[model samples]
Target: MVYVEVFGEDRVEKIKICGDFFLYPEDRVEYLERALIGLPFTISEEDLCAKVEEVLGDCVLIGATKSDLARVIKKAMVRA
Candidate 1:
């Protein structure tokens, strides 16, 4: 599972991503986290998925996909 914290009103000021999933080239997750930092809180699942895919590139993920990651982000938004 992933836990995310998003801060801002009209725009995303910051984002924190934490999870127990496995991602190859582990630093890639940091890239993903950074990519999401300044995005709008209202960003759609598809857009987030695209960003994840773009950042991930050819990296291998164990037990997760871009969609799954996007879904987790969406859920975090809902809870926020």
Candidate 2:
């Protein structure tokens, strides 16, 4: 799940991401969360997916794909 706090009109102030998924070099998860901060809350799924892919770099993720993660973030943003 993604837990986010927004700032201004559409920026992400803080965020927490967690679920059953596993990310190797496990610290990459924290890095991903950090990277997502200060981003626009209304960001597109494809753009978010690309950001995730970039932040994840060589790290390996199991149980979730980039698009899946992007969709989850988009859903959470809408809910927020």
Candidate 3:
């Protein structure tokens, strides 16, 4: 597994997976980021929040708060 960080003003910081592999775009970290391109960072805070909400909707956040995010990431890393 690989790790990635997402950051923006008013956006919750996060670390995501760039799943382990040895290939082209699949292994390209930038490509993984590109998947999140067009997210509403430049829009209103509500828009950004909505975008964040949408993204996280597909994810199962293991904890209720940021303090546990890293631990969740680490657990995912080990399981991978």
| C-alpha-based local distance difference test score of model 1 | 0.77
Better of 1 and 3 by lDDT: 1
lDDT of 2: 0.75
Give the number of the best model, judged by lDDT: 1
lDDT of each: 0.77, 0.75, 0.39
User: Looking at candidate 3, what is the lDDT of residue 30?
Assistant: 37
> In model 3, which regions exceed 4 Å deviation?
1-32, 39-41, 62-80
- Please give, for residues 1-80, the per-residue lDDT of candidate 3 as tens digits: 33445554433233354434333223333333454454433344444345434444444333132223333333432333
- Each model's Cα RMSD: 1.6, 2.4, 10.4
What TM-score, to 2 decimals, does candidate 1 have?
Answer: 0.82
> Over 4 Å off in model 2, which ranges?
1-9
- Structural similarity to truth (TM-score) of each candidate: 0.82, 0.83, 0.29
Among all windows of 10 consecutive residues in model 2, the one with the lowest summed lDDT is 1-10
What's the distance in Å from true for residue 68, model 3? 13
Q: In model 1, state the lDDT of residue 76.
A: 69
Q: Give the lDDT ranking, best first.
A: 1, 2, 3
lDDT measured at residue 32 in model 3 versus the true structure, 0 to 100: 32
Better of 2 and 3 by lDDT: 2
